[model samples]
Target: MRGPVSEGDWRGVVRDVRVTGHRVTKRATHGRDKLLREVAWLKALPPKAVGYFPRVLEVRTGEGWAEYDMDFCPWPDMSRVLVDGTLTVDEAISGTRSLLGFAFDVLYADHHRPAPEDFFHVSYVDKFWRRASAGRGMSERFDRLCSAEQLDIHGRVYPSAASLMRELQRDTVLLARLRPPCLGRFHGDFKYDNVLFEPATGRFLLLDPRGSTVTGDSDSDYMEDLAKLRTCTRGLYDLVRAGAARVSEGEGRISWEWASWAGPALQRFSALDAWLVDELSVKARARRDADWRVRLDVLMPLLLLANAPFQLAPVNPRTEDIALVLHATGVRLLAEALELHGTRDLGVSP
Candidate 1:
């Protein structure tokens, strides 16, 4: 039997034993009350969803524990595939493209005009802003980093987080002009481990859709998977390793270890993303293409910013410093991306 695996929000206790002769059981639990909500949503999925997720065999709820049993998926976990070094660039690109394409097709198959609330559900932005601005040390470091007039952020210079934030907000406004006519259904959580791929069938099984429903905010769901995918695949593990090192060294200052490890991965991810966006633009039209590009530009930074805290908060004390550095990195990336095209788009330079 596999021991418990803990991520940010939930701990999954997996049992290798079968419910009958062939069915394995997994008991997923959360320290908070969220597990039951996820269970409820999993149980309520329409039959069509079974093709993209595991089949739920049973469910139970109690005071401090929530659990569910599902057929053990035989497909390979995508994260393991990546970690094992067997994941090719083509495979990574295909897997994400196929899975996201399928989700969009299913969710938008019968779409009409987007719900009115979709246009205004910018809560994701606000949520990330709150988290990114919350850590004093990280903010202080970010302030220090930005104080350098020569601080090169991907070839652009940001004088301060304030200037960066202003540029990001400005880009947000520009990208807002090219929204899709209607909001469609999307996977709220599409991390790699949450996705299972069957090589033989060229199909993907998506797990753990956000169990909660948001009225009129479906637009936020768009490309949410891509944002998370880029984060996890590109930098999360490096940040984790960096944090572990910082803890071991007992220093919170920025170190070469982070850049040494995460730098290449981040670069690779950027190239991959550019390739994907280009491929998608050719397949979709100009408007849809622009929306996806904008999502990569604006929405991804927000997602990364919001996730920085969640990633850092649950670790032991030693790792807190690492988390702070990681958080600062996310903010730095956000600022850099916001200023990528410079202020020419806004008719001014900062």
Candidate 2:
């Protein structure tokens, strides 16, 4: 099969060219219209933010399937950088600094003024429940796991998943309380693996981005991006994806056992939570934003919970039952975060 050749461009279609190299085709096989939004966002990127993202070479669509072809970076993504056991700690830190620069300068650049967006509604309630009730009982496993009295995952105690969900659901004021600093030009799905490093060009490029159709009414909110980054640092998204977590039921409770994350890149990534808080604090103080930590704390677990359903129905390969473990972990984390911070941030205390 021959790929669509552009004027004066060298290209050929290799059958089943799913692996990334020079150019890659992203197909929304589930009729989700993800490619449409991705193409839209790629086009919407500021002209100045050129090198931060790949160039869109082609877009093709059909009934129940949409796809687009774009340049693929040669470097490993941040997720791989953290756990693939190749890059050293120093190398990971330096590369991560560059990744942040590229991401903030372009992919998550604040292009619009602040708006009182109901960030909670978008980040937590909408993303999570949308899947739980999205026709299939995709998230029911999470519900089952959470129904336990308590969760002990990797030696950490957490509230029951159902309990956390009920508390978060009951907090009506918090749902309408989140007002983000800016609401323009967000990457949609700004997670670790989606970011790539191009060595020869010293560029940190972004891959998958959530289309507007996938999220809220518009493409904005860097908080989601921050939450995703935190998902790696704190939520341990890459670690979980790497099959480091195990799930089990015992003595009337669900528990998780984890392998030690001794990879070279993880030592550095694991310590970044404090640094993230300090960095966000400095920025929030500069912005005169009060209770930024509270907001982030609230946002983090929501992002985790929102991400749970997708894990249950992952497109990439995953360890068997990792999705349930991920959901259980999110529930635990949410229970922990809300318990520590309390519901004052939500404008009501329980």
Candidate 3:
């Protein structure tokens, strides 16, 4: 069996070998060295964690072509499950709860260990800055869009995107001084696409751990993975899949018209938010640190903002749509985060 190429350019292929009784994948890219680096990183995971990832079997490389073979696991992609709406609320909570526990057991278990030199450095604001700098200023772009669209920010109306952008950045700067309660190895990319749930075993498996960042090190921010999960729950991916986000060519302009869906999306995240609060609260209690909740509260918006530009890269024609929805979602989340001022409500309704 062969699986379609996963959603991006330069992604590898997934294949199952029935006769050989194993699964395999072959990834090719313009740079063999880069592919090799990813393979090396995957191979370095602890033996127990290796079962969660595709097992490496063989490797071959040449100029401009790097290919590797790996044993595959047959599991339906969660993104497809989300798009199909086949997942029950119980299933969603179960998967997420299991993931949180598993991630804690795997990545957070050794928080004190010195980080590897090759660990990726995650620049929290780099994506927002990059997209914000491109085309027109981010504020100006959003201003024009807001003029055409009605955005109700907690019953207040913004005359332009400039105002909203100002608020978003203001909160971001204030959040910069905060530190995570804990940091350690994380599934650098912990979005739905990289996740799979096996109904039989009731286990969640992750794929494609980012081996390196542009700066040639690991992005050791554990909050990033959690933030990415929240972003998905906030409907960034759903909006893209539902055709609610549209992007214009050449200018890279993006817009999202799914106003009615925003509330429900946040509602869907309510359970997860509460779970996170509870989990963090337990940690804070153990350490006698009340600020743990605040750290998480402020960190959410910043991470969301960082994700805005992530989808804006020129990977497809819908680049603008991806950017627009992610940017708007991040901005909305940022506003909610700011309004609460690190309070427990967290803008996720009861």
Candidate 4:
């Protein structure tokens, strides 16, 4: 018998997750397509050489939704570990090394050379403007905040959240130079949220991957994965998502604060990222990949810009306050990223 059709809203749950014997079933009630993507990516495993990732058991698609089941992993994901302070610095580093080993040793490949040169311009820059424009047209509040040239967030002045990206895009040639030196089959959304680490056995599992890479349906820049991880670490994404943030509007400006938190979790994450940056920087220079590091720098914040617009959408009023924090985070980081490369202003409109 057919069940009652869903409006696609989960009310609160993205899936109806349950454990049946040794298997875990994730029946999608929202964002079903996302689950489908995960299923497809997971089904195409990277072998057992690098240890664990979810093993897709079965996938089911319906009239307007999808669901899948996989091996049960009782361990906490990196996000929960970060919040609970369970994941230690050593574990973080070790787990990441193992993950990257898999990527480097197995996933690295040559599907395309040097990308399209306009990869960033097309993938990130265009999508950012399109999302922001549509988002601003959704609400006057979003319109005002998104339309502003400069914003004072946490008492710090930043260029508009979406504008700096446009500024970077103003000079297409420069955007063309932002490609990472190495291209490979990538875990498009590689971040803490997608990683599950078990401290006891020292085994980690990655769940939920984008169906394909950013630049294509097959391969992508390796730095894209690194940038996504940096978003959680140096970008304080986990901190901000944990409600360790404040946002308010007044005096014709919006203010967003990545407020204080007690503990070593955030600090530990920052350290991990710092280590990654230092290590990668040396190798980038050795390869004479002038744009490699800069591309990574730019990608870190472009990731935020890629998703910030969804927060601005009027779909759920509950996520409204989060919009500003996301906006400011991207803007501030984009400015800093551009500065690191000595990238000059392209005279993009305020």
Candidate 5:
């Protein structure tokens, strides 16, 4: 049982109760009957569809509040397992894929709504560039936080925010197009922490659906979104690789500089990446095409480069090392994109 769940100013509680040989959870809230009603609606889904979620048993409306009963599961949330270092990379990926697949399935099956555009279009690559471009002042905010020990990792020093932003922007670009074709539904918040993996059976159970959104639209838009998402996924993979590298090189303790910047940056990046995956999964299940997939393959590296900096704390270093990595990665991604799509004049756009 959880809550007092709050919606704006209203708050309430969820209690666990057993009724008629079935375990159920109940929610009580004040001045927000709609939320309770939504929960009830969520609970009332058919057992098979609702089984992935909690089943709604009953709903009660009162003078100033509403309450509903729902089925309950006893397993621990995947987030707990992750923080404890109990999950393997393969397990994380499998669990993430399954949860996303289930989210897509449920949204279409239950609500008849299509996926949302921002879900697919946004990427860590985009975020990375945005933050990096903010320059020294922005990076300094995170830097000060680090110097105070408010942030810590294995001990590696962080790159300055300005450096990271420059690196990101030098690597990527964003293109806008119409939405993609509908393939299926999506579980809107797919991530490592939200998926439960049973170690014994290697089975995954998805938890959390509060952020799910569905929108049925055109194929072009969908493809564009998917491309961005794939890019985000690749970025996340690179981050994991970078983190692991730091861990291995530091002999179990990450540098304080690296830890401060990377820790918060990675956490935020992962969340954005998970959201992108959920968006892409929904599009992929509904429509299939080889070209879109190929484009994504090309874009992934570019996006990865763009978003790499926001995930680290700034470290004071020689100009050459910073400039070299940034320019190299940027040029590589840009060259690859041009090779695939043809060279366009590089100048500031009006």
Candidate 6:
């Protein structure tokens, strides 16, 4: 009997069946037709190359949903592995790289463009940055939630709704202008939750491609995006620097005690810094294809300032790091804005 299976975003019903004397499971989601389409697409691809995806058995359109049967291999997701502390960093990275590489190869090589009807395939990175920068509606929603309860920030009251709204709007504009290149196909929602890993064999299984999409944007927009990403990423690096400085100041310079406690904290900070730099550099290559300098000078700092608050929330040695980075980056961005648009003090109202 088929019953509801509570997974992530997709709605599905799973049932038990015997296939060739082997007891297997069948999962169906008629509400989501795209799953069937993607499954078909994957099946059409060379089996050896697309072995990561589930082996399809049958796809039949029924009353309410499409019935999809595959060889049900019960595997644990990355989150489970993380909770159990079983997955090594190397294993995780390799697994992630495989999925990302596959997506990129398929889209770029095959020219598997996004269909006109497929809006759901829109990339998550694009969506996140766009929504983050386009602040009015979201800010209002955030404000309404804050007003219903007392919000606190670093022993201080949260900023007024209007202030939050203004900040969000400013951030949104800066991020939208940063136009990072969409290289072929993207996983859309590339996060730990959607990935499964077998720690023993170092195998990673990527499930649910509901968010995958084809890249469709101009070269200029893509370049601008990369430039903006660099600025935002650099801002993150600067924040780490500021956090380290604060930690040093708070706990005197060069002490064994400080070194022991702060070592792990420092490693995390370095990890964040390294990730940002590598990501920025990887994305920056696309910028070489267009007029990046002009757009970079204009958008980089703004993107940095806009993203500061969100990046600085976690209470690590780098707690104050985001604020410091924002201040420094904001200075450059504000100066440029003034230079271009003239000194117009849009001071905080209310």
Listed per model in order, the count of residue pairs whose N, CA or C atoms clash below 3 Å is 1, 0, 8, 0, 39, 8
State which candidate has the highest lDDT: 4
- Which numbered prediction scores highest in TM-score against the true structure? 4
Question: Model 2, stretches more than 4 Å misplaced?
Answer: 1-21, 107-119, 135-143, 149-157, 169-177, 198-202, 213-216, 260-266, 314-320, 344-350
Candidate 6 weakest ten by summed lDDT: 248-257
Which candidate would rank higher by lDDT, 1 or 2?
Answer: 2
Total clashes for model 5: 39
Order of the predicted models by TM-score, top scorer first: 4, 2, 1, 3, 6, 5
lDDT of 3 at 206: 82
* Tens digits of per-residue lDDT for model 1, 113-201: 45344342344534444444553343334434433343333333333444545555555454453244555555566677778886556
lDDT of each: 0.51, 0.61, 0.53, 0.67, 0.40, 0.40
Reference-based lDDT, residue 59, model 6: 67
lDDT of 5: 0.40
Cα distance off (Å), candidate 5, residue 24: 6.6
lDDT of 2: 0.61
Q: List model 5 lDDT by residue over 1-350, tens digit each.
A: 12232222211223233443455544444434444534644654545566565555667766665655655555555555543345544554565556545544554443333434543333333444443444224344333332232112233333333333333344333222212233333333333444556765656655443321212121122233334334434333333423322222122112322344345445544664566555565555464532444355445544444433433323333322232233233334444444344333333112
lDDT of 3 by residue, 58-102 (tens): 887766667777766677776656545566556767777777777
What is the Cα-based lDDT of residue 51 in candidate 6? Answer: 65
144, model 1: CA deviation in Å? 10
Instruction: Give the RMSD in angstroms, all C-alphas superposed, for model 2.
Output: 7.5
Better of 1 and 5 by lDDT: 1
TM-score for each prediction? 0.69, 0.80, 0.68, 0.83, 0.42, 0.46
Which candidate order results from sorting by lDDT in descending order?
Answer: 4, 2, 3, 1, 5, 6
Better of 2 and 5 by lDDT: 2
The residue-by-residue lDDT of candidate 4 on 21-128, one tens digit each, is 989888875677557756766766656423456777788889766878888887887887876677788887777777666655555543345666656666676656
* Ten-residue stretch with the least lDDT total in model 3: 1-10
Clashes of 1: 1
Q: Would you list the clashing residue pairs of candidate 6?
A: 30-65, 30-66, 133-172, 134-172, 178-224, 178-225, 179-225, 180-225
